[model samples]
Target: MKRGGAQHEESIIGASLVAATLGLSVPAMALEVTPYGAIRVATWWTSSTYYNPAGDPLHDADFTLDLQGDSYVGMRVKEGDFSALAELGAYNPKNRSAGVELRMLFGEWNFGNGKLRVGYAPSPYVYRSEMIYDADGGFNGYASLFDGRYAQIKLSMNNGFYLALMRQENVGLAGIGATNSPTTNAGNGYINTPFNMTSTTYMAGYTDFDTFMPKTVLGYEGKAGIVTYGGGVAGNYYKIRTVAGNVQTGKDEIYSYLGFAHAKIDLAPFEIKVAGHTAQNLGNLMNNAAAAAGSFYSNNPATGKNAYTYGGWGQLGYTLNNKVKMFTGVAYESNEMRGRTSDDRMAAFANLQYAVTKNFNIVPEFAFLNEMRSAAGTKQERIYATGIKWEMKF
Candidate 1:
C-alpha cells in the first residue's frame, strides 16, 4: 500500500513538470512584420519672380529633375496588442542625397478601446491638400496647415477623437517675422516691423525665455454616410524675460492658439474637400510659408500684439476613367496685425493623374501662386510651375 501511494505521488509530480515545460516551450504571440515603400521622381520646369526683389535682376526660369522628398520606405510590425512603425524618407528637395530622414518612428499599443502612440510621427492635427505640384504637396504653405512630424505622446479613441502633447518652440524674439526659410516670394512681401531691437535666436538662455508647457492638440474625425468631417484646436504658452547685462528686468507672457476644420464628400466619380484655419501667432507653433507671412507682430514694442492669419482651400476631383483622374483646387491666406501692414496670398492648381498600372502613376500638374498684398515699398511676385511626377509604389 505504501509503495502504491509513493508511485501515485511521483506520477502527480511528473505531470506537473510536463505541464510547466510545455508552457515554457510554447512561444508567445508571433509578430507579423510587413515592409512597404514608394519611389517618386519629378522632372519639371518652373518660372517665378519670387527671388527677384525690386533692385535684383530678372532671373531666368529654372528646370529641375529630382527625387520627390515624400518618397519613403517603412516597416510595420504587429504583435498582438502592440504595433510599431519605422519609416525613412528618401530624399530632400534642398539636397537630393544628403541622407535619409527619419520620417516616422513610433510604437503603438491598443488598450481599453483606445490607442497610445509615442515617439516621433506625423502630428495628429495635420490635414493635407491633394495639390501634387512640388516635391511635397504644393498647397501646404498657402492653404493647408501641416505641423509636420515631431516628437509627441498621443492618445486616441476608436471613435476618432485624439489628444497629443507635442514639442514646443520658444518664439519669444522681439520683432520676429518669417518664421521659416522663405523658399518662395511669400517671405519677400514682408518687411520686418520696426523695433529698437533686431531679431535674435536666443530663446534658450535662462535670461531669455521660458517655455511653460508642450503644445497641446485635440482633434476628432468621423464618417457620416457619404460625408466625412473633422476639426481641432491647438495652443501653447511661453514667457519672455528681459535681461539687461545678465540681470532680469521684466518678463512678458505670450499665448498662441489656432483652430482648424475640414470636410469631404465622396459621391461616385466625384469627390470634394474643403479645409481652413484661423490662428494667432501661428509661426510660434509651426512652420508654413503662409503662417510666416502672418506671424507674430512686434512693430510697436511698447504695445506689442500678436499677428493673425486665416485661410482655406477647396478641391474638386473627377474620375475620367479607370486610368485617368482630374483634380483642381484653389487656396487663399491672409495675415493681419493691428496698427501694422497686412499680407495676402492666393494659389490655384490643376492636375491630371494617369495610372499606367496599379502601382505606377504619372501626374502632370500646373500651379500658380500670387502675392495679393505686400507691405509698403515691397514688390510682390507671381509664380508659375508646370511639372510631371512619376510615382511607383511597392
Candidate 2:
C-alpha cells in the first residue's frame, strides 16, 4: 500500500511539471482582499457667536452630538504587482438622510521602483494636521492646505519624486450686476464695493468660461533617520469670454499658483509635524470658509486679479505609555486682497487619546478658534468647543 501511494504522488508531480512546460492549465495565485473600516461618534459642547463681515452678530452658541465625518468603510485588493482600493465615507449619520459617498477609489500598478496611480483619490499635495477638531477637520481654512480628493493620474517614484495632472478648480464671479446676486443674463453689471467708493460697472456677464489645461503638481518626498520632509509647486490657467451687455468683450485670462512644504520628525515617544504654504488665486483650492474669508478670487473677473494667501500649522505629540497619548497644535492663516481688508484666522487645539482596547479608542479634546480679521475688517467670531470622540476600528 505504501509503495502504491508513493507511485501516485510521483505521477502527480510529473504531471504538474509537464503541464508547466506545455503551458497547460494550472492553479494560479489567489487574489488577496481585505475589508477594513472605522466608526466614529462624538459629543460636543460648542459655544460661539457668529458675526458677518460687517460686524453684525448673526448667531449664538450651540451644542450638538453627532457622528464624525471621518467614519468610513474601505476595501483593498491586491494581486502581485497590482492593487486597488475603494472607500466610502459617511457623514451626518444623525441626520434623517445619512450622506454616504465615495471617498476614494483608485488602482495602482507597481513597476521598477515607481508606481502608476489612476482614479479618484486624496490629492498628494495635502498634508493633514493632527488636529481632531470637528472630526479631524484639521483647521482646513485657518492654516492647513487641504486640496481635497480629485480624479487624477499620478506617477511617483521610490526616490521621492512625483508629478500629477488633476481636474482644475474652475473659477467663477459672484455679487455682480445691479442686484447683489450673481447674474447669468447678458447685460451691463455693476460691482458694489464695501467701501463708500463708487461702484465699478462692466460687461455684466461672462460666457465660455473654461480652463485649457488641467492643474499640474510636481513634488518630492524623502526621509532620513528620524525626519521626513517634502515640498512642491502647482499651477493652473483658465480663461473667460467677457461680455458687456449683449456686446462681446475681450477675453480675460486668470492664473493660479501655489508652493507648499512640510516636515515630520520622530524621536522615540515624541513627534512633531509642521507645514506651510503661499499661494495666489487659490480659487477652489480652499474650502468655502477659506475662500470667502480670504477673498481668494477677484470680485470682478474683468480685473484678472488674484489675492495672495499664506498660512501654516504645527503639532507636537507625546506618548505616555502603551495606552495613552497626548497632542497639541496651533494653526494660523492670512490673506491680502486688493481693495479689501486682509483677513487672518488662528486656532489652537489639544487632545488626549486613551486606548480602550486594541481596536478602540476614546479621545477627549478642546479647541478654540478666533477670527482676528475679516475681509471687511470686522471682528468675526470666536469659538470654544470641548468634546469626546469614540472610535472603533475593524
Candidate 3:
C-alpha cells in the first residue's frame, strides 16, 4: 500500500506580504484582492501506514507541521465594462509563479451588476464537495478536481441560475476525473458564492482531449414545500497520462454525474438535510479513466454507487455558557467508481471548532470511511486522526 506524505504541501514564507496587502484595504468597490490563508503547525500519530483513505498519512513525525493553508493575496480591478486583476500566493518555491497555484490573474465584467468572471483558473464540471465520504479528495484535492487553474468564465443571471466555462490545467480536459455537485441544481452550483463561484464548477466550451475539454453544469436551489433543495448535473472530458506522459488508449472515458439534494433547518440545536443523485456514464465521449477498459460499474440506483448525495450537512452544535461552543456535524457522500473491487465508498465528516479568543481559535476533526475497511494479510486498518489547528485573521 503506497502512502502519501504531504508531497504537495504549500509554502507559507510570505505571511507578512499577504497580510500587508490585505491591510491596504483599497477603496475600490469593484473588486479587491483580499489577503487570506492559514498557517497551521500540527502533528499527528497514526499506527498504520496505509490507513488514511485520502492518501496522505496522518502524521508519524513528532515535528511541528508547517502548513501554509489556502492563503492567497490578489486584487480584483475593473476597467469600465471590462474587469481583471492580479493574484499570487505566499509560497513561490516548489510552485508555479505563473498564476498556476497562485491564481495571480483573474477578472470579471458581465452585462448584469454581476457580469461573468473570466481569467486563469479552473472551470466548472470540476465540482467537488467538502468530503468524498471521508477523504482528501474533499480536503485539498477538490481544487485539483477541475484543475481550476486556467482560462474560465462565469455568467450570473437574475433567476439564480449561473453558467460557467473553464479551460483546464495542462491545457485540455479529456479523460480526467471531474468532480460532482452537492446541490441538485441551483443551490449547489459551486461552493457558496452568490455568483456560484467554486472549484467544482466546469463551464468550459469544449470537451475534447489533447489541448482542452468542455465542462458544463446546471445548478439551482428553490423552496419545495417545507424543504429547500438544490443540486446540478456536471460533466467533463479529460486525458489520462502516466508518470511518463503515456496517454490512455483504447476505450477512453468521459464521465458525468447529476445529483438532487436538499435540506432545511431553521430550528436550533440540531438541523438536518438529505439529498440524492443520479449519475450517467453518458457513453464514451472522449475517454473514461474511471473504468479499467471493458468494465462498467453502478450503485443500487436509489442510493448507492449510481446515485445519491446531499448538501448543507447535519449539525448538533451547543454553546457551553458562551465560553465554549461544542459542535458536531456530519455530511453524506456517494461514490461512482467503476468496479466492485474498488468499493464505491461513502464517507462521514465530523468536527469541532473552538474559539479560544477573538483573534485565535482551535479546531479538531475526525474523518471516517464507511466502506474503506481494512485489508487482509497486510496491516490495513481503519484509522483515526485528530489534530489541533489554529486560525488567525492577522
- lDDT tens digits by residue: candidate 1, 55-146: 45354588999989999877777778998887777647876434557789899999979999999987666777668876757587786787
Worst 10 residues of 1 by lDDT: 181-190
Supply every candidate's count of residue pairs whose N, Cα or C atoms clash at under 3 angstroms. Answer: 0, 1, 62
**What is the Cα-based lDDT of residue 139 in candidate 2?**
76
Q: After superposition, which runs of candidate 3 have C-alpha atoms over 4 Å from their true positions? A: 1-37, 49-64, 74-100, 103-105, 120-150, 168-213, 221-229, 238-255, 260-264, 269-277, 281-325, 330-339, 369-381
lDDT of 2 by residue, 140-198 (tens): 77777765677889999999899998866554543322221122222323234322112
Query: RMSD of candidate 1 to the true fold?
Result: 14.2
Residue 250 of model 1 has an lDDT of 56
List residue ranges in candidate 1 displaced over 4 A: 1-29, 51-59, 95-98, 172-207, 242-251, 297-299, 302-304, 375-377
**TM-score of candidate 1 relative to the true fold:** 0.80
- Each candidate structure's TM-score, on Cα atoms with residue i matched to residue i, is 0.80, 0.80, 0.56
Per-model root-mean-square deviation over C-alphas:
14.2, 13.4, 11.3
Judge candidate 1 against the unseen true structure and give its global Cα lDDT, from 0 to 1. 0.73
